[model samples]
Target: MATTNTTTPRPGGRSARVQAAVHQAASDLMALRGRAALTVPLIAARAGVTPSTIYRRWGELSDLLADVAVERMRPDSEPADTGSVAGDLIAWAEQYRDEMSSEVGVGMMLDVLSSRNGVSVEGRLPVPCQCAAFTASQIRTIVERGVERGEPVPVIDTVMDTVVSPIIFRSLFGSAPITSAHTQTLVAACMKTARLLAPVEL
Candidate 1:
C-alpha cells in the first residue's frame, strides 16, 4: 500500500497558523515524549488549541501524525541531475535507500501507514497514497529528463515496481541491509527493463 495524502484544505490566515502550530506540537511531542506518551489532548494543550479543534480537523492522533510525516518527508528540492539517466537513477536510488532506511525515515513511514485505515477529518479529502505520490513525482521528473535526452526511460510503474518498491519493502520489513550496491542493482534492473521496452529500429 502506497502512502496517501489525506490533505485537508489549506485555509489561510489564522487557520494556517493554527494548523502549523498543531503540527509542530505533535512533532515536538513525538520527539520529546514519544508516540507512547502522546494523546490528542496533550498535543492540543501544547499547541494552545482545544481538543475539539484537533478532533474537528484531524479526526485521530494517527491521522495527525501521518500528516506531519508527509510534510516532513516532502522533498525540499528537485532530484539531483547527474547528466545521464543511469547516473541520475543510481544517485536518486542510493539517496532514497539511505534516507528511507534511517531511524527518522522509518518512524515517518510507520506514522503514514498507521493512518491507512483511519477516517479522514471532516471536510478533508481521503488520502490516496500521498507517500507514493511523492515518489512518483520524482520519478516522473527523471523520466521526463531521460525523454528530452533521447534516453530510453521506463514507465513510472516499471520504475516503481523494479526499484522503489523493493527498497521500501526491504526498509520496512526485511532484516537485510539496504546498501548502496543493492540500490544500484535495482536501478540497473529498472534500466534493463526500460531498454527491453524501448522500440527497436527495423
Candidate 2:
C-alpha cells in the first residue's frame, strides 16, 4: 500500500508568503540604498509583485519599511545559556556585533530610528524597540540567574548604555567599524564590572 502525503496551504499562507517577500525585498533595498531610497513601486518590482498588492497589504511604504526593519533587526535565534554569565554575555555581544555590522541590519535600524529625528512615519520606532526588548530580556535573564546564584545583579542599564549602545551607535553612524576585538573588549569589561558589583549573600 502506498500512502499519499496530503498537505494544503492554509488560507493565509499566500498572503504570508507575499508579506515575507515584500519584507525581504524591502530589506535588500534598504541595505543597498538606505531607507530614504525605498518606495512602494521599487519594493513591488523587487518582490515581483504589484504595487497594489503591497499597498493593499501594508497600506504605505513607511509601514512596509517599518515591518521589514523590525524583521531584520529581530534576533534570529535566542542567546545561549552557557551556565556562565561571562560566557553567555560574550556570546550575546558577539551576536550583537555581527548584526550591527551588517549593511542590512545597521541600515534598517538607523532608518527606522532616525526617521524625522525620532518621529518615524509609522509613529513609532518598532525596530529599535524590538531590538532593545530582546537585549533587555537577555540581560534580565542573566541578572536573575546571577542573583539566584548569590552573585550581584549588576546595573544592566549602565552597561548597555555605555558598552553595547556605543557599538550600535558607531556602526550606524559610520563613525567606526565594530570589530570582533571591540566586542570582546566590551564583553570583558561588562563581565568584570559585574563581578565587581556582585552582591554578597547575608
Candidate 3:
C-alpha cells in the first residue's frame, strides 16, 4: 500500500483533514491504478491514516468512490451561457469530453458504474443515479433557456442519448477515442434533432 507522509489540517479539524485525505487518496489511486484496484485499505494507506478512519467516515469503499466520482465530474466552473443554444451545447459537450479523457474522471466513472448494483468499498451503490439526473437537469436548463429566447424547444433525451451517452459508452468499452470533433458534431446534430423532436403546441 503506497502511503504519503504529509498531513495538514483543514479549517475544520482532524475530521475534515481526514475526510480530505481520504478523498485525495481515492483520487490518486484511481488515477494511478484503474478502478478495479482501488480499495479502502489502499486509500487509507495512501492518506497516512488507518483503514478504520476511512470506514468510520465513509462506511464503505463504494460510497467513498461514488462521492469521489461526483466530485470529479463536477464542472470546474459554471456552464457557459454563450447566448446561442448551439454554442452552449457545444461548450457543454466539450466539458464532458474533457472529463471523460482524464485518467481520474474516466477510471472512476467506469469503476463506479460497474459496481452500480453492488456495494462499493463504502457498502453502497458505486455511482448515484442522481449524477445522471443532475446532468439531465442541466440539459433541461439549456432547453428552457433556448425556448425563452425564442429558439425551438429542444428534445432533452435525444441530446443526452446522442451526445453524452456515446462518450461514456466509448470510454467504458475501450472503443475509439472520443475526440473534440466528435463532440462538436454530436452537439450540432443533437441540437438540430432536438428542435425537430420537441413537442409543438397548437
Which consecutive 10 residues in model 1 have the weakest lDDT in total? Answer: 1-10
> Could you give candidate 2's per-residue lDDT for residues 15-88 as a string of tens digits?
88898888788868876987678789998999999999988866777666756665555544556777777776
Model 1 per-residue lDDT tens digits across residues 81-190: 89887888888888888888887788888887777444365543354466777787777777777877778778878888989888889889999748888888889888
**Superposition error at 176 for model 1 (Å):** 3.0
Candidate 2 residue 43 Cα shift, in angstroms, is 2.6
lDDT of each: 0.78, 0.66, 0.69
Off by over 4 Å in 2: 1-18, 28-38, 45-50, 56-62, 114-128, 192-202
Per-residue accuracy of model 3 over 1-202 as CA lDDT, tens digit each: 1101112222378877777788889878866986789888899999999998878766777778876665555444445789988888888778777777666566667555644434557866535354565566667667767877778655777877898898878776755658999889888777666552233430
Give me candidate 3's TM-score against the actual structure.
Answer: 0.70
**Candidates 1 and 3: which is better by TM-score?**
1
Candidate 1 local accuracy as lDDT? 0.78
Indicate the residue-level lDDT of 103 in model 1: 79
Better structure of 2 and 3 per TM-score: 3
User: Against the true structure, whose lDDT is highest?
Assistant: 1
Per model, state how many residue pairs clash: 6, 1, 7
Give all TM-scores, in the order shown: 0.84, 0.67, 0.70
